[model samples]
Target: MWSAPTTTAALLTHVVRGAEEAGYNGLMVALTRNADASAQLNELSEEWTSVHDVTGQLIAVLSPDPEVRTAKIRYPIVYECAAMHDLRLVPPEDHDFGFNRCFVGSVHGDQLRGRAEAVPPRPPQEHRNAWTEAASRCASYFGITEAQIPAVLLLSFAERTAVLIRLRPRSADSLYDLCKQVAADLGWTKRAAELSARQRALRQRQHHLHRVVDRPELSRAKWRSRSADRLGSRMTDELRAQYDGLDRHLSSIAEVNPALVQQWRARLAELRSHGTVEETYRQLFAIRRHVIAPQDRQKWRRLAAKVGKVIAATDRVILGRYTQFWNLDDADPITAELRRQEAEMGRQGAEMDRTATEARQELRQIDDELNSVAAELGDIKPKHDSEPGLAAATEAAARHMLGQIDTDTVDGSAGLAGYTVRVVRPMAEAPVEHIDNSLSGTVFGPMVQAGHIAGGVHIHQHGLWARMRRWFS
Candidate 1:
């Protein structure tokens, strides 16, 4: 049987209270790889949040045992951590939202540790007020109004930026209105602009839209010239020279025949159409090495040998090619080398085929063993539902899985307000140096109802999604 709720009463009470106050009354499951963590320090922020976890909480939380109960997470802080995740985390097994779980713990892939635990706590009113004052001071020092403060404020002291997440579960107005209201609530009035933006000094842009321009479309011949220019740019000088020589020599020989001229042009166009110029040249070069070069060597040998047939054939031939090119002598040295290489390739291919066959047979045997084990273990129902440890094991094996320490972890014993004295410290004389303050944030309106907060922490308010964008960044 599981232990009583008092073990985590303080952890549970704080998160549910904070989340409800923020209008996130929905049930949530918190998982972590923090098997040894009770508090998570943002390493960068040096912010300490307290955490409470049962030894093996993940499976225990999802267990269907009657003794199992819901474990509310530490709020606000965990949500900030969650926002860092690009995708939502769902455990391998279906969640028992009806208090079927009692614990949570560490998980690596599908493997579950002993039990589950959660972390986090929100900043209290006074700390919240202190944060507001600091932000106001930053805006004033910079000579900008509260509405003009960037979405992200990078202080001079801390290595990490201070992202202000104002969760106004109570307000429904534009982000601009919320900023103005926030300033008013803080007893300050200094807003220089309407919206947040990240300015970039260097950017590429299209030519002037209204001006007329003179430009002619390229013809096929122009494309061919363009191809040569591109080839020189892409390849080394020696390679381009070698290719140019080949093209000139081939053109001189092929000029004698109209058919040869057409064939050469078509080949050049095809080679130029795709891939790098060096790669295309290699295809033509390989044909010369493996085919043409050997033939020329044999012709030279035969001519030196004073063979009547070779001399007579040369007189009749058009530049020793343009027809005699495909005519192979079978005795070419490259031909002999290719035959030897083919025999070696055949043996390697046969060995690969045998290994593939053996692998297929081994896979079949493994499949049979797996089916046998699955049939035997399928009968156990209680283990699947009662024990989170087993469910984590089986579900992990099935597929998928793992999340954050929560708010209470941040609050520890002190409230969120007491957590930090002053978060907005300026560098030198500048109020805040914004690294990037673009409006790239994706805003989501109330996923749940918004009546939870009667009046907002600010006048017009922001919600969870906005809070995520602020803190997660």
Candidate 2:
């Protein structure tokens, strides 16, 4: 389906032949201005003359170079003639097609035309190497070692300062070890004197061991404040504004009920600092039960439960490891095997907690759906119950009519006279229609005999009264 020819002429010839085989009326031929493409000029002349009698059109592409080199070069030429005997070329000044890249040569009815333009060159490798070398030298000048240069460049200066703690020389004398013995001894003595002087200056300020009694109340309040501050600062401006609004809402509540924020902060702080594992659980549950509304209580309860489970699971992991060690205390032969088993269980406990949390979330979603369905049912009750009211009325009317019916002769024919009178009473008794009359025509005709009505006309009389009452109501 595709071919890469050695020469532009060979490629163009192939393209032309392929186009002709494919039944094309026009051919777009592209050419490069090199020795490889020189053969193309002759090929194109031959193809043009051969196809002169044919119906197809031929177009040639050329580079912009006036003095074309053997390598890759493209530029515009101005001295080329426009009119010739065999083939005439029309040259246009300042064409959008730049000679720096590639140009087109069109041949149709002995008219040959070519246009050239310049193409943009790629940046050389020497420039990139120079920039990289400069950047590396600058990085080294700022105390960044070759090994740490990449991290220093990517992370902030504060982060770099923190990492520098590990990079500090454990002993200043170690650097001098590479020197001569006398020089090393002299350097070590000088460093010791300097360190002694520095320590003396620092010792004058305060005692090394002093109790740092942070007020318990202040510490707890700071925890919530810092957490909220971190949450806001990490967000974008739009989200920060939303958090600001929440903070304002809390501030307003704090102004009205100063204990509201204090209570939560105090409880949280106590849990974080002094409260035992079990004490924290009790405090959290107490908050959920007393402070939060019932509807919101479940979420807090779930959070507390999840946290408790995680803590307990972590403690179990440690306890399980300790149990393994205890078993190994009595048996030396399988100590390594027991320890491995303990490690395996500890790892699995964390994994199991993760799986349990995911399953809990899924069940919570199901619970929410069920609650929603119950609420929807409550909303649908009135409408669902109202639909059957008319049917009940119709059934009561039919029952009353059948009960009141008496075989009485009016004039020469035998007929029921009390049926219509009983219909009014049933209508008064049941507000909805009788169920029998609401049935199909065939069902109503049978019900007329069953009801002992004065023909089928009065069989549906109660139905009309029920419908009228419903319409008015």
Candidate 3:
């Protein structure tokens, strides 16, 4: 379509009629810049610019560019064609109409360019012949026909002459073939060089995309930095208004769930002998009553059930009487024995309380003596403030060992005997001690002979401390 502003109404009629004959669902009739129909179709052109419409089919258009008016505008048009054919224009965003539509333009280059200079005459037939030969040479170098050149070439020519010669490549497959031939003609003779290079560049881009997609650690760190944007800073906003409204609806409840913060704080404080978990759960449930509706007291009920199961399991593991403990249905003699034991425990507890008081006094008296004896020897058991970090470094070294289980770290060290595990906190009073035992034909021979050791007895722990000290030093 070409535009003389005076002829746009007639051109639009022709375009609309042609599109109807071609069975298009809709047509986008475009015009040159400053043309009479520009204002009439601005909304329509904007609508056609987006690829997807309501029905998930590609709406047909010249291209996203407002000036497209020819069949050779193939980059956007061909992609849109593929989408229309495949019905892949799913409405993935808002403001979508339907997916199947078309556009026609009636615009000349002068009007599009917003100029009134006299159009330069076309080159004579001699120039056309020479250019054709040059195009053929370029095409032959790339082992492609002249028709396979990309549409950008025509757009370049249009800019120079205001004469848009349509350029329609046969297909993407053909264009790819031409690119390969071009690379070969340009002396990239290696196998699939151009395609491989492009693929490598694309792969690098995709890898960067994958890194971004997989970066949860970085996301959490960024969230920490931007935490000032959190709810506390925006308590007067619409979001807060909605939150308040929701809170009003839930205000009649007697209690919400027991706060996890309080529970963890209690756990941190009470580091008594193991099996304290059951005691914690029991104390939590004793605060709740069964009279409340299940919906209101569901959390307490769940805690009670979980604690009961744990207690039942512990009894089964240690006493080998899971059913009797859970059902409260032991045999008569067993029941009698339990009752007797309970009574005896009550009496012994009182006696033990008195004994504990006296024992504390005695321990105070001998504390200095005990300290002197302990000072005479090296530390019996090392302590670590960050126990879990020490444990993790041990794990990392163990993993390293597995990779080198059949290989040595350096020199000719073999088996687990050559490694010694050690942990050093970032800033702390002392490092965790995992002494090696080189004498027992095992990794920790010396440590075992001098004294029994607990914590950090992994195979990779052999002699690692010496190596770590060497590295640190």
Candidate 4:
């Protein structure tokens, strides 16, 4: 039995080739899709133009010359069985079908007939479902109901595949029986049943999906009431004012340019007569001088600018209405107050951060100076007993340390000065063995001890040993 293939093109080509080889002059194709059948047939004829006969003659005899034997050969007829409701739909009267004879027997003869007859028909319920689905799909495709295309089903066989055929009102029941017999002979019963079931399931799923996706909108009354609530008197007045302003501007421009109407009409006529869209647009620009008077061109320019402003105002009003209805804008008084407070807090936070950063910088500077002094003091330890210059160096270092403290105090870093005093007091108290009994030690030791008595009010003396070493060097 001939089993239908997945693609329409494959099935159509196979059937056409089979019919041609079986000595059929012309074949009628049943179209299931919503399309122009005649146009589709013409295209198909060209697409399958390379099919050949046993003697290497082009099998698609209906193709346009000069590929076919003659240009006079009639093309295959394709009809929308559901839409047309007629099998007698024929080609033009001028076309010849003299050599064409519709085949009733198998194209492969009895060679495959026994195999086709062995396959059994599907259950009645399956057959009914298949039939209903096919009819429903045909109706949906044409945007009609199943009742509009009420017709008995028929099957046409080619190879081992079966093509579903929907017959018109006048179609003979005997023809359907004959087709069934032909299908059985070709062993296409099981394959045809399977294809029909698949088609039914696909159409059902599509119908369900479409229904799910197509949600109904709110009623006109509800929509109108909601829009009215959102669009207050203020918005309406603004929109009306914008509209009136645009109208007044346009009126003024029109009054200044009395020839504008006549010029527009003439330009429109010229545009219609042009060969292409680009040419029409070019002519439109060329006729601008004829349309607008020289003195009124500036008025028109002003009017155009006013129109742009009016459009922008209208867009804003509409957007405002939608925003209010959807609660999309943060325009509530409470929200505005919150935002202002947040901004104030952010500014305060930023100022505090800046002050803290400056304080840290000042403190780091103080720590660096203290560390320098300590390093210089450590260097002085080895040389203090040997050198007499230790006293002058120690005095100089105490002077530098005191100067740094005064400078820090003047720069508004009094906290750094106090911290420096606390740091220096500890270093001054630490014993220096190298400077114990020497004259350098006598002079420097007292000076270093004097730094501790300066208190937190001033920063002094912890680098006496460092100065002594520098003096000796």
Question: lDDT per model, in order?
Answer: 0.29, 0.30, 0.29, 0.32
Model 1 lDDT per residue over 235-270, tens place = 444344444554554455553455854565466556
Off by over 4 Å in 3: 1-184, 189-196, 199-205, 217-225, 229-473
Model 1: what TM-score?
Answer: 0.17
- What candidate 1 gets wrong by more than 4 Å, as runs, is 1-39, 42-263, 268-283, 286-341, 345-350, 362-473
Give per-residue CA lDDT, model 2, range 1-473, as digits (tens).
01111122212223333333332222221211112222333332333333222211111111111122123422212111111122323322224544411333422211123221122121223212222333333333233334422211111111111111111111121111111222222333223323333444333322211111111111223323432332212334543343244344444445444686577556655544444433443443454344345454343333333333333332233222122111212323134434555576577757755655665565555456556655655665564444422212222322332233222112211111111211111112336765763445344333324555554453235588889988999
What does candidate 4's lDDT look like per residue over 257-373, in tens digits? 558644544554453343333333233333333334546446565443344444345335543322111111233422343455456546775675565566556555545655654
TM-scores for all candidates?
Answer: 0.17, 0.14, 0.15, 0.15
Candidate 2 structure lDDT: 0.30
Residue-level lDDT of model 3, residues 325-367, one tens digit each, is 2222223323344465567657776775665566555545455
Model 2 scores a TM of: 0.14
Candidate achieving higher lDDT, 3 or 4: 4
